[model samples]
Target: MEIFFTILILTLMVSLSGVAARIIPFQIPLPLVQIAMGALLAWPTFGLHVDFDPELFLVLFIPPLLFADGWKTPTSEFLNHGREIIGLALVLVLITVVGIGYLIYWLVPGIPLLAAFALAAVLSPTDAVALSGIVGEGRIPKKIMAILQGEALMNDASGLVSLKFAVAVAMGTMVFTVSGATIEFLKVAIGGLLAGIAICWIYGKSLRLLSRWSGDDPATQTVLLLLLPFASYLIAEHLGVSGILAAVAAGMTITRSGIIRQAPLAMRLRANSVWQMLEFVFNGMVFLLLGLQLPAILETSVTQVEVDPNVDLWMLFVSVVLIYAALMIVRFGWLWTMQLISRRLLTKRPMEFSAYTLRDLLIASFAGVRGAITLAGVLSIPLYLTNGDAFPARYELVFLATGVILFSLLVGVIVLPVLLRGMPRMDKTAQRHELQMARAVMAGSAIESLYKMEERLTADVEENIDADLLKEISSRVIGNLRRRVDGKEDLDRSLLAESLERRFRVTALRAERAEVYHLRATQKISNETMQKLLHDLDLLESLLVEKEE
Candidate 1:
């Protein structure tokens, strides 16, 4: 317990420190860098060793990360791309599993096809952390990123479900009949979906009721929202269903019906900040822990296993590497075929997202780096088979998983970016064209408003003076319109103008609250102090709102 706390403290300090920014030069992602740091610490000479309960890692990290991702995802966008997201999440996973399973079995020959299938299943899902890092801040097209994120989110459930089935087959705990497997799959999948919706609905309604009377304490609201994900997960898992799917479903439900749809502006902002912070810390820990576990995993293997000097570890290593390539190749093939189908039938004219050419296919292929879900499933593999005998190839399976992660990180992160660079760049002219299209939309609305005003004031106008005012208004409107349409007014600058205006007001309110906090933190602040401070905060908040207008 002491060791665990120490490691946690170190991880927290490293993540919160800005030192990582100086470590990487070429737009390397923070997660990847953190993992590298962990690997470095795990080296024999470095002598920093950390061990974690795999179960604890899941309990601590996975739920919040999944929930945060689910909550922030725009439901409307996800719904619009539901078909494509489902295709990638469900169908693509199966394709990688079968394809990689066959390849590994063929290459290794010693490992059973079923064991290979289990490995493949573990490697099928993509990492949300990896995807988010690679595609930063809507740098990619919103629709494309939405599909990627949505797929990554759902695939955690689908891949984990598939993994449990693979493990069952491995352990031979459950009899494998085609009909029985089908029924089991339905039970888990359908059960998860139903459980998620039910819990989310109830929880969301509960939140609405609570918020109505809770005085909207931002910290309190944030804490309740954080608990909802874990509670939903626990309930579903306890009921022998997919906790992951339940979490996903509940998140979607809450966002759709609770906060995004109904919460006040301040509440939404508060919730967003809370989720973002949780996401940051959770990701930092994941990569840090991932790195820290490397040495321990090696030490455990060396200590537990009796080594045969003649055993061909190289053969196993080579075979797993080949299998990793096969997984990626299969992913690419599936994505390409899907993209071809979508292009021909569904999407009419897709534009490039970011500097990448063939954005959809490349994003689909490169985005398949497996992480936490895969690691969890692999680590959860039972130690003994159904016959009360030792499980086959257990340690080798762990090595194989570690190999997959390393290979994916090395190849996917390093190679994919290079591949994407070759794609066409959307230059200044193209961006200007998009801006013009947006301005046209705003102008059309403004013109409609003017038409309504002209209709109402036609009879009330005393000819000359009224005509002059109308002309001046029209000219002013046209200038604003042309400034936007012709790209004469910088979009970023214009947005900054509004942002600065809002920021000033929010700063003043925050200052008043900060003074209250200072008083409380330094000593005992009385109820009088609290009440007066709140009154000032309330006035400042009103001023802030007025400034927003």
Candidate 2:
């Protein structure tokens, strides 16, 4: 209870501080500011004892966060950029592990090669929250942001797998054979994929059943939606499969499987809000844990110094620099390769992805900080061997890893922001114009459809009496619609009409989707089921038109 209150208070304080910082126009990252606050409060003089469990840190914090990320990602964009995402997420992680590990073994003589690789794997994944400010509500093109997000997502799974492999080798549980490890990796990946698909399919079917049988209570439905991700994760873990993958798969399935279709609009809205809140809370907690773990990690490393304390510290410092430099170089090198390949592929067409500019890619490379999962994996490193010889350099490794994290944060949160400050801000005017054009096009199309309907009706009626009143009414309606659609010709002028049209189109799309959802929810319906039903309805409407004709 005391811990819970303390956390709540700290969270509130951070929220307020972030708000205040925006007004004060400070350049510091909000997360760094939050961490500094916690560190200050937890200093020995202040004497706050905040210890978070490693298992809870992994299970409680990671799944929902990852699921939220997957849910919010535009699925279409993810599908489009799937290849580059694979390169960055999977291939780049392997590169970081191999490159950084070899550098560490050479630079720091005593460290085991496998352990160095493990530490490298831990640091490869980027933090979603850290990049939130840089990505800035995804103001960059959806394709670029999707690649960033998908890479981050997949790397979380890959990093965990690599950490497992490294620890197994470090502890001598399994022989390190390239072929054997490759086979095992495939098994784990395939097992995870199958488990996710199965769980999401079953769970989505069950949710649809609930919507059919239960009373139309939006709150209850919202609660059920909230539990879906954690339930999928827990079930997968219980079955010895990858819970993270399962959660993501389940979220994706629910979104795509007509579960969202069957849901009430209010329920869907509430569920989105709930997930957003959960994402924020989990993100804050993960970073706060990162900050709190820093002091202890430092203390442990300080106590582990053996070969001439001064010399040992110097060696560790040098190793960290070498590892960080190696990782940055590899990240940039891969990104440049990707850019060249992409340019060649787009020879016939102009590239649409924003943030591919060399400056942004450099910023991305430096932004590769070890975040919550990295810390959790490092912290979860087994402390005692089966024979009970303390895991070799466990404290030292922790310290070294923590140092790398702090360095990455320092470079990522502190230095990169300053460098990026000079880059061009998002083109607000261009974005507004694009949105305005989209609105005008949609509104004009609707008006043209209505005119066609009016013309067809006039042809069918074949009546000219009382034409004056009809003319007045039609003229009034068309005039109003014309004014709404055509008033925004000057793109430079701020147009409320465009804003209204944009909003209206969005709401109309949502309502149409909601109706389709209702159709899907009504039973074991297929696409043909809805299509046939709609076709019959359309045929009946046409028959009525023919009878009037």
Measured against the true structure, the TM-scores of the candidates, in listed sequence, are 0.76, 0.78
> lDDT tens digits, residues 1-549, model 1?
878776676556456533764555666766667777777767777667665666677767787787777777788888777777878888888777778778766776456777777877888888867666654454544556677788888888777777778878788666677788678767887798789889878877776787788866566666777888888788888999888878888787776774555766666676776787777777877777677776766665554444634336666677667777777678777767766666666556432222234655666676677777777777777778888876666666777787777677777667667655654443545564455457557876776787787666665655434777877887787666554444434656544454575698688778878888888878779878888888768867865675344
Cα lDDT of model 2 by residue, 484-540, tens digit: 467567765535554555566556555655676587888657888778666554545
Relative to the true structure, candidate 1 has a C-alpha RMSD (angstroms) of 7.5
Query: In each prediction, how many residue pairs overlap at the backbone (N, C-alpha, C within less than 3 A)?
Result: 1, 1
Question: Lowest-scoring 10 consecutive residues by lDDT in candidate 2?
Answer: 540-549
Q: Tell me which residue pairs clash in candidate 1.
A: 38-291
Index of the highest-TM-score prediction: 2
lDDT of each: 0.71, 0.71
TM-score between candidate 1 and the true structure: 0.76
